[model samples]
Target: MRPLLVVGGRELAARLRDGTALLVAVVAPIVLATLFGFALGGDDDPPLTATIGIVDDDGGQFPASVQREALQTEELRDVLTFAQYPDEAAAQAAVDSGAAGAAILFPAGFSDSVGEGNGGSVNVIESDESPLAGVVARSMVDRISSLVEARTYAVRASLEAGVPGDQVQEFVEANGAAGPSLTLADDPVSGGQVDLAMYYGSGMAAMFAFFVVGASARSLLVERRLGTLSRIRAAPIPGWTPVVGKMMVGFGLALVSMCATWLSSVLIFGITWGDPLGVFTLILGHAFAATMIIMLLASRAQTDSQADGYTLAVAFVFAFLGGSIVPVYNLPDFLQSLSLITPNGWISAGLTELAAGAGIGTVVVPALVLFGIGSVAGVLAALRLRKGLLS
Candidate 1:
């Protein structure tokens, strides 16, 4: 056991001593994260801002009071940046060119229809790609519709009660308090905690696990090629000692990498990963499972190149099917169901549970599953190596 530990330590030290390993392990991930942050839109969403182009064919005679009310409302003010266009073609052009998020047109007699209590509708066309713009346009349209409805109701009351126009406005104003307020629900569980970020982060870690495990497994092949394995075999140590040593080293390195990624996301990216103990457990479990899986693949592969190819193919396939590339929810039902067989899927789910405030106790099942997988893979690898098939 002690000899194996010494051998494992020697192996780890040799790998770490290389300047290139540090570049690959630490610097590369940081650079990639920074690039991803830039390309995927800023880490923080730029404040909601939209350019709305308005074309009024109503000859400067549209209801100023209603238009002002629509533009200045609390909801629209925060979301829309309004600009007047001279004609429908110009407004449409602006929206099509992405200069404006949306275009609104008030047809001729817009005010006259509202004045007669007929409740006129304006046309709103928006660029389909801008979700924020669609939300703003829809909100503004709904508010305008409500205002027109309120005015029509006021006219009805005035005619019924024989009240003056001035008193009718007061009548509607006095008794218009029936609908729900426009407060948006701010619950993160239901709304704010974006799921894509979760998928990408988990996928990145899972993909990188191949490197750690592959490198450790490659160390064994290198030892055999160099006659070091024969020396170890002739030593007083048991046959499994070197295998245990490699597993320990690989597990430790995997854990460190997991911690680095989790801490980076929390501190630099402002992500809130909940329950430290739960996250730690998941990280450790995933590290062991990933390392064992790679070692098993290494044992089955015929050469270094074969091992590398096999590990890459397996890891990436798991990543893709387990909701690392596209969201699990967006996948077809069969694919989503099939994700259960993937270790990456379990790791992703366990991490999500930790992020959602689950404690170590809550993550016990997934952690156990990870440990079970690791145990099975490790046993299989050890048996294969003992049979001299891997050499």
Candidate 2:
């Protein structure tokens, strides 16, 4: 055990000194994260929005007031294009027929409720055909509702406390929003605080995990081709000691490479990879699977050249189909469907969920898939390695 540990530890140290290894694991992820950040607009850029239908059925002035302000407010003007309707039926039909992704129907008593210091039920007709647009409309409605609540509750409380009606209106008007509003700063909260950095970082790291397989193939297959395996088999140590030591060395280095990428992305890029457990769980599974599969392929190849080619073929093909180079979401639906079979897609999907503030329950499914891949591949590799080497 001590001898194998020493051997494995030495290999880990040697990997630390390799410049190309460091570049793949650390520098490349940072560079790609930066590029994606730029292409997607800066960290502060506003997200996409849709034109939401607005139906003003109120006897009072709440819907009219919001529309008036929407025309004048710079923030609202930029994000929201509101098409006003006379009644709820028209607005609801727009959503139902897919003419509008979402609609906000202000009830007949909406403005009256505000004057009476009571809350009204806002009828939201959101479309299933445009889920993201529906979400944005819902958020907009929530902010507007909160503004109305603040003003209504304040005015009502003041009137009940015996303040003059005109005085209460003046006070409320002075402190409250000129109209309901939204801001660019509030947008990222819908996802997480740092989405851009985490998105690219996850893709880059998952793609680079395959590079460690290249390193593994070179380490093990080159040694075999040089007769080093036969020499080690001749040693007086237990039959499994040298094999376990070599496997440990390769797998440990792969873990370190991935961890270095993950940490640097968080520290330097300001990416908040939500849920500590979620982040590490997917990364650990991905690393183990990549390392094991690479070793298995390398063990099967008869020569160093064949192993190198095999490793590259598997890595690039997986990376392409999994969306490391091209986004899977942008691909045709059939191709996107196919990405589910690849570990790259599974890890990328789980990381994307983490970036969106998902926790253990949301990410455990992908981690389990990765674990299954690693376990099955590791068992097969072990069986094949014993025959390939002991013979």
User: TM per model?
Assistant: 0.61, 0.63
Q: Count clashes in each candidate, considering only residues at least 3 apart in sequence or on different chains.
A: 0, 0
- Model 2 Cα lDDT, one tens digit per residue, 101-155: 7888877887767765676767788776654446556665776687677867888
Residues 174-280, candidate 1, lDDT per residue (tens digit)? 76612223322221221224433443555566656656666777777777778787888787877777766776777677677666766666666676556788777
Cand. 2 Cα-lDDT: 0.70
Candidate 1 local Cα displacement, residue 177, angstroms: 27
How many clashes would you count in candidate 2?
A: 0
Best by TM-score: 2
Error of 1 at 145 (Å): 28
lDDT of each: 0.67, 0.70
Which candidate ranks first by lDDT, i.e. highest?
2
Residue 303 of model 1: what lDDT? 74
